[model samples]
Target chain A: MPDGFDQFVTDRLDRLLRYATAMTCDRYLAQDIVQEALLRAQRRWGRIGAMDAPYLYVQRMVTNEYLSWWRRRASRDVASPATTIAALTPPVGDPAVHHAERDAMRARIAQLPRKQRAALVLRYYEDRSDAEIAEVLKCTAGTVRSHISRALKTLRADNRVMEVL
Target chain B: MTNDEMLIREAIGEEAGQAVDPGTVLAALHGGRKPRRSRGLAVAIAGVAVTAGIAGVMIPLTASRGDEAGPAAANAATGAQGEQTILVLGLDKLVDEGQRPDSIMLLRAGADGSFRALSVPRDSRIDPESKLNMAYLKAGGGDKGAQATAAEVEKLTGVRAQHYVTVAMTDFPELSTAVGGVEVCLKKAVNDQLSGANLPAGKQTVSGEQALAFLRQRRGLPNGDLDRIARHQAFLRGLAARLATLEPAKLTALVDTVKRTVHTDAALDVLGLARRLTSQSGLTAATIPTDGSVDTPSAGQALAVDPVKVRKFTTEFFGNGPAPAGGGAPNGTDTRTPCVN
Candidate 1:
């Protein structure tokens, strides 16, 4: 409950949650992961808050939480495939036609391997550069680029099948 | 951006755009832990702080005398300037014949937070009449056991430990479960009835009671207690790898379990140890130097180790001096779960 930590939570909690949601594709898991990350961040905020980008450190924590083996094993069945469908379900009575392509894209994004999907989400959704994505992913910039490239290749392959259909 | 990129961004943005409940996060942040505060006001203030959104400034009240460290220093300052040497003892279960210290480890943490552990084989001769393991039973068996063992260790190695941590082998199950078990590799299948271990060769994750058995089996090992020491080192290495990769939530749970399970000296600084565990600073482990097997009148078969060689190995390995250039199983930061006998 230090001033810097509270202020950080007040300002960036929403954004962190959004990023987590995109990465996890499960709102509840996102909430849990973001809360856990922030809890840890606050514990050492005296050091983290002194960093150049405190949010980035917390963001990396959130990413790591989502990528953790236990988290994946626990949330694999409950989230992603099921909750993502629920979230992507077009709202009743709205024009659901134009959303079909975007919905398909979202589904494909969720189907990517967790790391590649993570790289895609960080690069496209968070508007982070490849270097920032590498830092968050704890990989080289070349590795991050490869992840993004491979993910884009998979999504494009799926799109080609859709075009043929 | 191209059309596909635009569609990807829009899809991700739309998928992620949802209102997050801020209350839950604030609750977790404010009400996360009470052990960091004084016992008297922990419950009363935690609830009020969570509900009212008002909490006191982060204070390192327990940081006195280097017992604990402030949050800022917990990472950057504590290990950056000073090192800590801890004597880690694993105690066996009590039966009709009383108990003995199962394993002894000399953990020396450097100023950079990296640690090197020296495992003293339990069968090493402390004197012509007594083995190293007998030191604990010679004295009364609780805290005195740790002190007696530390004294023996200091006499043998000429290095005094700043603190001691003792864990009952009975707690290994819960401790292993807390970290989701640890993966260990076996060079050959084990079927030792004395230790209740029936494990196959190669790498596998052991938890709960199986983990206890895995660490306890020594009868069938080619080197006996020496091989068991290797098993201990392998388990510690696997545990360290697991802990290093654990996320914050699991790390917190593991830390809580450790606080509840392990008994340490008041000045050991558990949080500081946790910080070191979390840091990327690696671990180097080796066993104390030994000559050969000896049939002792007091402790039966024991390893014949000279105290002079033991002190030299400790000084060279734990000291800033170069590691003893020779044949000791000194593995530095390999991070592999070594296949052990």
Candidate 2:
């Protein structure tokens, strides 16, 4: 590995894949987008890996790749089965959140606008702040706020999370 | 965190284990693409035409060309100079197909790193008898074609240029693909089969054959060739973005892609110009300021451009004052990026 990139990839690849999966709502497309981002990342990894936030940078690239793919897919208007949320098995302790209900929530989340979904994924899934999300999305913090607000509006409309939002 | 938020996190994290094989992804990076074959060059006309086009965007690998340019001349070109100009002509040429000069541009760069380019329409009046687009065909192509075209451009804008380059569209695709495709943002989707451009709306990276079509299609565009000039500016800016990070090895291949049409002048070799504008700054593009049109006794209806207005455009684009009316954004680049469509 060049400059300990092997370790860096090991540290970040899984996290990147999860974020990508959430963004694309498809495991296969997520893998493809992550691979595409990583391929491009390798070209400049020598310069970027030494930066203060190499993983964050690569994660941003993954987001861009997913957005690009999203636009491409949208224009083509092709329907894919995996775009639907997959059913999840409930973990041992969490009986209040039924797996089927979680699946319904995930599907509803996927229906939000791309920016909204990305904001939710970055904010909740990656545990990033509005400023950090802005940095990653290359948008103003206000725009990030709007994306989150609009996204949460949809979530709140769902009877399951009406009070939470 | 709220319980609902915690549940959402847990829901999304279910797929955290999903991943592509890193080894396969890494292996594909270098395995598929090998260096291209056959070297190419674009002959630069020297002595009279200014060699300028937002060289800010199309500049590639001056640092890599250091060995080729030696030390002295390379340094001089890269060092800021006082008052320079060049004529840049972009053409669409395909195998066994007729060639057309679709983009006619003039650029002026003062020593301060400020630059402006005027895109003259292909149908602009050169003489009462013929359109500016026919200059190349009248000269039977190649160097003669570029020279004849440059002469007409000189007449139209009244700017004497000693350096010129006529770049073919054939080479642009390979170059765009080489740089991993250039991102294009269109307010609306373009679908013109005649020029082979069938693109969806928003931002996308156009590569190779598709890019040729993207650069070629002028028909069915909102304002015909006029809008295509904006596309040219945008594509060039994308190309510029790609060039900023071009690898040293790919730079050689890129230079090998274009067939040169002019040769007598070494002062404005493509390599030197490419190196000088590697910085890609203070660039703007405009259509030659034309105030509507009139019918000539011999030439039918023609665009009416006052030389005075053009000079004013020149002044404002270089930051002397406010820009004159009639022109698109300072172009061949994305002023709206980082948060792309």
Candidate 3:
């Protein structure tokens, strides 16, 4: 009974954390949201564990947790030692200019609406197909495409503004 | 596809790569208990002991289990063998208004030294026209306010609070600085004039004025006051952890801050409770489950909390069951402090 759930956590916990971290842009929040989602999944493991792609359904939970976190107040609030954008600072050896560009781009992505940001992260960060992204976002594939396009359009416009500056 | 997309991918990769392993989470999962977070968070979970210690007053008792032996235990019972529940409040210092409790928590300290804390959001609906925070104001603030809030908590949770404790929000700065500083992280950089917060995105130690700003900034947060509450919880966790290991001289200063800022009922033994909590682990902190937000006629917008659910949750939490299932470790167990938005 418990083996499936434990195995699932062992197999997918890190990946889920990574997906959550990418989506939320906050590793601590990602860990928390992922843990919350997984705990909920574990509670109903009898049902969720039987599904074909439990990981996919669990991913949906993580996505919804990220979107609804601001809407529904998160319950457990603990202080993590390394928080915020500082964790996003690229590995030490990148060129100074490259680091600045990456930081600037990350800030721009953070500014996108949560859904659009999720779409971009799904496509670019996770390399997920539109159908897979749709399943997680609970939107149709067409909406997924539109989300990515609209996000890109905004990024392009912001990029031009930065260039002009 | 585009240069911008490539940049976005690279940025997301760098951030995602920072995701840490779920070692602590797994440990708790296997233990069938809440993760034992840092000594600081244990202090937050053990709300009364640490806060009262910092406030330099009686550590307010928690849990309605006082129904069984709480009242007697709170007042004269010297043997700390049974579970005790205490209502703890943090009062916000308003300029024109007297004061209102921004944080309301029911903390239960078990005989074994384990603790459970349940935080009721300030905006939780007490009635159709009023919120939980208003209970304090309606009761004319101060000790009376603590009584009113305690009564409301009792009514909501179906348990009686044997003892109550109150802390001033203004004292947070001094209390925070007294322990050197409380470290906090923000997901995004913020510059809010309303709360006097001007900080860059990253992990940094905050003290004095900055600490107050970090706790008070709600205007620009994504979840408004709820987010602010999270900040306060995290800060308390960090502060409590520090208080747990404070040196004798620094502890003396903290006690002075606590004395001026904290108010409790006459019965509680502050130092005794502090000693029990500081040396223990197994603390779990949770917020009352809320069903989104609603626009109230009297209050602008309030958290639509179901009293039934709240009571049920508390019953199960404070009840005799072996902790709630899937109890993730309370926060701050990780060596790294989590960054918040």
Candidate 4:
């Protein structure tokens, strides 16, 4: 209803959705996550505006909300090894081959534990500092570094991801 | 930390470039419904009968009638001068048999531009055998609760609470919807029968009633009130992020919403000051370090408020220094008040 809210939604919606997608590894669920995060922010605009980095705050919310959802659902077996690599392959290739490689990288990143994935996402995707990641995760900077270290190790071990990178 | 890591970070940043529209997200958060309590609701709720009952229950006590007319002086003296400390209190456990504070948080913005929130347990016992919820109730309810709670908090912590803001339960849904929705992480499925918040675990966006249910559901929580406080803090953090990305119109609508629902002694001019103080500051939220619970002789089992420990917490948070300019004398300020219906 306000003037800039619509524009704000339009401008940042895609990026937030991508963040959700990367976090959940599911486009539909990612869309839902972004939407919910935005709505919550809208309702508390007054108090939110009073904060320092409102975007980071919302991103943390989305991640935390996503984790809460994960906690509720029964854990499924990790996607089969065969399916995992296939899922990471980009659908559209040709001139956008680079985009496909990036997509595959994102898929690999999503397979990490929620916290690890979040650490990687914030560190690389959002380009946040270790301290910033710690703030969002409510952990110490050491914890964030450990998450990154472990996440990197996992990514390195995944031969397919290594090649893509 | 390495070049490879930096490359990965660039890729991730590129991926984040493709954010989704928040409008749809906002709709989903509100469960795809428009705000129910519009201007009409405010008008209807303001009628004589409602006012009479609220007034009767929430009359302020004239304990120390000092300078009530010097809010301007208080602002001028307190603004960005020296070592400033804000006291943030969250009223998570203040449930009165059936009623709850929804969520109450206090933030002490220091002069160094760092802010910390001191979460006051709702169940924590105060003087006169009242729980933490009464502080807000005594402050005339709604936004007044923050004011009353802040006043009492200053007494307990020996910190000057210069500004206060209070938001109601209904604001949760509207805000969630407006920002699209909020994403929260749960360790496992939460089917809170008490609050009626049923959800599968993992990352998910919740709508109107669901958001309220999530914040209000303490019985099903592992640590009960403690977990609830964590959730409230997480939600506040998420809400702050969503607010940063709003467009002009949505920002205006949000401001209008604040004008309607949020009650603060902070004037329009103080808005900029508050914003500056909070922005770029490390906002730390900590529960009032106490021994959790205390057994009272008259009041069976209650959450204990350790004045000595709380005093220490105040000192650490606000920096044990000279009181802010215009701050009244440190002694005789009573922060404990009972909220009895």
Stretches off by above 4 angstroms in model 2 are A1-165, B1-60, B63-79, B92-100, B113-115, B136-148, B259-275, B280-282, B291-302, B318-323, B328-341
Candidate DockQ scores, in order: 0.12, 0.08, 0.12, 0.09
lDDT of 3 by residue, A63-162 (tens): 9977875332212111111111222222245577677677767766765777998898888977999999999999999999999999989988877876
Name the runs in model 4 displaced over 4 angstroms. A1-165, B1-103, B136-148, B266-269, B274-282, B295-301, B318-341
TM-score of each: 0.50, 0.49, 0.49, 0.43
Candidate 4 per-residue lDDT, tens place, B1-341, comes to 76456547655665455444555555654464333323223222111111111111111000000111222224323445443333222222211122234333445545665544556666667775766656766654434555566666666666666654433232445656766765565657878676777978766666566766666666866566766665655454444434434443453344323322322343312222332343234434445654556676765566767777777765664552432222111211121110100
Candidate 2 chain B, poorest ten consecutive residues by summed lDDT:
B39-48
Candidates sorted on DockQ, descending: 1, 3, 4, 2
How many clashes show up per model? Answer: 0, 16, 24, 89
Error of 2 at A17 (Å): 50
Score residue B33 of candidate 1 by CA lDDT. 44
Ranking by TM-score: 1, 3, 2, 4
Q: B151-262 in candidate 1: lDDT tens per residue? A: 9999998988887765443234666777788888988998878777899899999887677678767687777777777777777777766655655445444332332224
Best by lDDT: 1
Per-residue lDDT tens digits of candidate 2, residues B272-340? 333344454445566776655656677566666666666556556544344455554445222632211
Q: Which segments of model 1 are wrong by more than 4 Å?
A: A1-165, B1-79, B94-97, B272-277, B320-328
Q: Please report, as a residue range, the 10-residue window in candidate 3 chain A with the lowest summed lDDT.
A: A74-83
Error of 2 at B316 (Å): 3.1
